[model samples]
Target: MPTDDMTARPTTSREDGLAAEVRTLLRTGLPIRLAAGPRLLGLRGVQARARRPDDPSSLARALDGLLREQLDRLENTGLAEASRLLFGAEAATSGATLTARRQAAADASGYEVHHFRKRIEPKLIDLVAWQLRRDSDTFMARHATAPELRAATRPLVLPADVFAWEAVEHQHALARLWGAVYLLRAELLTTARLASMDAPATETDAAATRALWRHALVLAAAAEYRAAYGAALLDRAGDTDLGPDQIAAYAGWTPPLSPAADLILVRLADPDGSLADFTARLDAARGGSELTADWRRALSGRDRDTDPNTLPAAAPEGSTP
Candidate 1:
């Protein structure tokens, strides 16, 4: 999730600025303010994932995700509740102003508005700021470790026709992409199950649904990448000038779908259904990913004239291919 935009880890002074920016965004709770907020705007990785860098809604969602993650880590229920109320993280208070949110927090926590403002508000903002700092560190560490990790992994045995470097790059990208998809899929399943029990819609529920949308976006991008790669392969095989439909007919290399993909496709078509609704449809379909089975079949198959013994042996664990 980290981007290439950050060249160095943030300093304590930079974190203090982030905290101030977070406080301003929380106080305004305006999309425009959030979109322009220096701290949020500086999250180039998050912005790059959005449909557009300037999208206020996407920026707001990212902010919400950070807050929710921090909230989930809190051990104190009172602080969590007060923080949620103060941030208008619930549907009922989402449209409330800063003063209204403060009063709500005060009423819920049995504290005067002034006292809550002087005590709780600052702490909540600091938490978010701390999370930002932690995220920056994580980003830097990931980049730092990536080269060593790649060096440790076995090299992929790609088709001879494909460019080795390009294939390796694609393989690495797909590995990360599918990892995200599966992780999001698990989260969706858990959240869907919780929704099936008839729980009230909370900010957490909304966050999960938004996460599904993000999963869908990633899938869509993967689909596009696969199509392009397939087209290139076809061209290399002397099959040129194929139309979109023709290319799509060659489904052997297509990204395999699961229940999550089915639900996402339906939601993409309608765009109005909730997580619960999608869960019901998904249950009816009872779908699962075919990726593993597909890979096994591809790897196990051979031509009639080909000798099985001539093929390369499997790469040993931790050995280079």
Candidate 2:
């Protein structure tokens, strides 16, 4: 006796047929065609989710839900608009003629009529076909055991958050500055912890320890500048006297060094120890070139070329990935 066939196999032909059907629905732009397309195509996922698989109204609603959910996930605005126009997703265009839909898609995508027909339209159809297959597979895997699970697993559409490039960069720079401040604080705490435990002072030289403290002070000052600058940009709920250029000048502002920082600079400048040298060095370090250089470096290091929309793997400092 021959064994029954139980192996799972790819359905390339069925998928191809579905893709062709989706293309027809997109190109026809006729209500009668769209209303009958999903049922005629025998979309298993749509049928499975519909209250009555055989009912055309139920299948149409299910298909609409799937398209809307997937379309909302698309980040590309132009492609989204094209898809919407082509599929008559908006009520205003539901009764539009095929030529009108084509022209609208071309205008939305910024493509010429010939180019949109030859390139963009095919891509739109393929995108829909792929979305349908993915949703179908997901529904089948989750709801095969109990059809009642469909309601709980149904997808929701939410608005996408879009930010300007400048705003994104500003926020990213602020984040980097704050991150540097936290790291410097952690190092300071660790040093204090070691001192409290009476760890060997030989681990770090006196000069190196002083340098670390100086760096921490400078970084903290930079972080403060960035916070105030960012607040000036975002806190626009009320009227302010400052103009845009005046606000921007804050980026290059030089903060005065703290007393501790001044003392450290004095010690570095005159290790031999003299009252006159201490006084002169302390006065010079208040807004000196060295302090300015350090502040500028700290600020520039935080101004990375990273895209705020993505979270790429960490790279070495001062390196672009």
Candidate 3:
């Protein structure tokens, strides 16, 4: 009945170990799924046979665990925050309509124009990035040794302001990449489910995702502090070469769960005050940082067309490695 009771009264080592694992997975997985009733009870039965050599309980349970883990992660990490951000008053009232929001900037003043360059933009990007960084922490907490967490933490630092800046930038960048990636992931999941109807997602899809993935990877690699890695990833992603395969890999894209959506929605909701308010918020969030450095350099007669020789070659444009 109770978790401790089951493990404490274990029948055999193999059974005990299996039961413990099943419980661990359920404890973690169920919460992630917000599971109740049937799913929970169903897993219990699966757990029972996990120790039976004749039963495929262990493998089946592992699959369920994996699926549940992914589902839970989707719920807990990004989707959760997205709800708040998107529906929040601010994002809902921004000056731009969905049509306008989707339109090209055409000029330098509309909400569509320089959305990426706006100070608020990067703040939102960094907000999501930080949340992601935190998610990484939770993932590591379960498996990381003490020293590892300490060492890992070294690279994640950001002046709260700077971290916040990249958070906004990355969020928009991700949005650009999201629609395409979701379509791909949906197709992959569908095919995986109906193998007879369709082919499984191929290595090509994985390759297509290289640009976005590599951008994220590079940011993680270049961060001044461990925590900043996520920020770095978001900021540098724009520079990465996008390709077909890299595009396909991003099919699983989902809105990040963070305060970002709230900001966007807030701006959307208050057509009158959204810009002014968002601008003020952006300034508050921007504590001192070199955030505008790249953009500044771009504006100061620096060639956007030429990659800086000082900076390492950006992964051969679209090459993943």
Candidate 4:
């Protein structure tokens, strides 16, 4: 007697159907764990190879590695490196540099610098989030884990080591978000720590000037609007002291945030000139450039941006749109 048997290869329709279903699930932002081997394999293949749908796993892994590297850099690298291109680390932080402080803290706490949750701000959080969004697939994979998602929204104070082991998703969006927050907070804390040292900044040279400007850009990207302004004030003068041209450059480097911008202007205001005249000179020095009016509201103590009623009582003399 012959056994009844059917052997047939999987059809094209079956493969196409599977691909379509996988795409739909990915669009919904579900976890890969919910997927079958075929789907996961396809997704991974697409992502790992940089094909369409851009593998979530690949993106996740990339972000994970980047975060890890950043933490390591923060730990192993000295403040001199971290501070080199940004604010004049030595001057801004007094004689002590970022490397020194991290080392000091590490020594005192008996924990690796990477183990502590560094103080950071929301702006950095935004930056990290923006970066994570660039790798959509990785973000989706990390999103699959509920605990990881929650952890991201509310970051932990512990260092990278504790979380590294739990590696739920590489380039975890939640992790990246939290890491950004940590970085921003740490920078602010570091700045404050430096300020509390209470030593007048040493005479900053041209090298320091360039560093401070670079720092200003980093702060701007992190949305440390105030810090960006503060860095400008701290480095406003050269080794020779505040000159006419240098002062103008400081004003132009002001962050786009109105409140922050006003603070810089206030800090850099010439003793002999009125605010109006000061701003005019600033404009002249910068070839008639104007600070956007919207930022003016930040100076006036309004929490929100400038609106119709919030317009300056009158534009400063010599002001142009």
Candidate 5:
């Protein structure tokens, strides 16, 4: 929407639609996000917020409605426009204009764009899991002293969809979330998507730059959680019965499992699954599968995040890893 590009070029219908999306988020989405939260400040009242661990028939209806709205938005939204609103200033090539940066994302996304969606699929699955963690935390904080907690646990982990439905409604809140996913995917595809093609990237390339992004967000999230909630919340971030695998569905999530910080590590752990199958596999895993660090070993050379000698060696596949 900000029409200032150093290089002038013809625009397509999708480009125009992207510009409209940018305008919509900047105008409408941001405001809606600022208001909807655990506080429920601008939203009507207590009745709207979930009170217990139970997911009833009416709750299913509400979540479905929320999902439909979110899917509609996701269907219409452009990855580039989203980039502009979220990290465009940071992601933008320093010398390029806003229009140029946006155009670059659109180009990287491709004309038809369905295949391009595949690039970001795994990260989005991880996003849903992280979103659930945050939403459960928010929901519990809101109902901290609720009567239901007398019979249940603090920071009660609810169904993943409950958190996801709430997350999609607060667009700006989830921008950093999806931004990390998009940026990570683009980073992985630099050789295939950017270098061999004719396009500009607002960001991507330069491992140092990519590493900076990786650290920057994680540090920010960790610091924000500590500042917002402090020592009192730290005691609640755990569960004795759960291992890392089952923790996804059960943690109270103190300051550590911050989506931008800790959960990003899990997202980075495996980047191979296609989105459609990835979510299904995660659901199956949650039902009962040992989480393993085999994904970490899959990395070769510089892709390795940790020294092989330092990490526990990978377990054999299909065993109770």
Candidate 6:
């Protein structure tokens, strides 16, 4: 799991900051849904029969290891100190809600809003619970000397008194927290992925998971969507297409376990192969990306006019993508 920073640092394709970093990790890394246990176990069984065997755990395990690597980078980068100052007090509070304490911790640590929105958005009672389990006096002592800890709790400094690096340092902590939080989700999702990784999950479950994830991915990839993706996707999907349990699984990090589900999503996203005449014709003319754009824009919380440039020529104003 050890990585040489100078050598192993990713040659990132863009500098769009934390959002891009997280998205890249999500896309390039193992789906997290197939991280371990029976599913991975079955994969090993499949590989034994093939001439060109694949190491499934390279993704299932290594991606998780990568997440931890990112977390260590954060802690060593001074996020641990940031946590000590910003969240030390309230995190040690006897009766505070875990949610409030987590927000305080994340805020104090300097996590950016965008980073929080994308990577650290999941449930995080574990971090707060870890903090709360500390002895009260020990908790207070660790943060007692950190001036920013007090400064964040109070409004002592003028705007001009603060330097940009201090803000940057705080923001740096957020990136660390985001990766760490994802590891937690990875653990949970992998469990579910491992569970449903078998034949136990119904065919309907796979169908629903694939539909929802594809819709969500399209919206997440597109920039023009102004409304909530959830409301839009659900509005279009029926109870049969996206079950409540499937929704929870997807949200929690469970990947669609079905090979059929995986293939369905990939084919839809890529828009190739045996298709209806109009659909194939549309792909041929406007390009597969444009059709995806139409679908993504169509599935929004509120109905809005689609950008003409982004959609295929035949994609009518209000029609589903």
lDDT of each: 0.49, 0.49, 0.31, 0.32, 0.31, 0.33
**Model 3 misplaced regions, further than 4 Å:** 1-163, 192-321
Residue pairs with backbone atoms closer than 3 Å in model 5 (clashes): 237-254
Score residue 49 of candidate 1 by CA lDDT. Answer: 34
TM-score list, all predictions = 0.40, 0.37, 0.17, 0.19, 0.21, 0.18
Question: Candidate 5 on 1-321: residue-level lDDT in tens?
Answer: 322121222233123243233233222222133222322221111223322213333333333233223333432244434333322322343235434544454454443234323444223223222322333344323211211214555664546796555544333322433344445445444423443453443222332234323333433333333444332222122221222122121211111223332333343323333433433343344321122222212221232465544543322222112
Off by over 4 Å in 6: 1-11, 15-21, 24-31, 35-53, 80-105, 108-321
Candidate 6 has its poorest 10 consecutive residues by lDDT at 137-146
What is the lDDT ranking, best to worst?
A: 2, 1, 6, 4, 5, 3
For candidate 3, lDDT tens digit of each residue in 137-192? 34312111111113464555557697577775555445434433444355445433
lDDT of 1 at 214: 38
lDDT of 2: 0.49
Q: Per model, how many backbone clashes are there?
A: 0, 0, 54, 17, 1, 2
Candidate 2 to truth, TM: 0.37
Q: Over the stretch 125-234, how does candidate 2's per-residue lDDT look in tens digits?
A: 66666667766655433211101224546555434545565555555554544444444455445544554555665432232243344343434444344455633323
The TM-score between candidate 1 and the true structure equals 0.40
The best candidate in terms of TM-score: 1
lDDT of 6: 0.33
- Better model by lDDT, 1 or 4? 1
lDDT of 1 by residue, 1-321 (tens): 111122233345245587777787787553233554666655533443333435677666665565556555643455666667777775546768999988887777777789778866676667656655665444332111111233547755657665787767665654544444555556555555555564554533553544444354445435554565643322211122332223222222222344444334434422344555543443343231122222222223312144433433221121111
- Model 2 off-target regions past 4 Å? 1-15, 30-35, 38-41, 75-77, 141-321
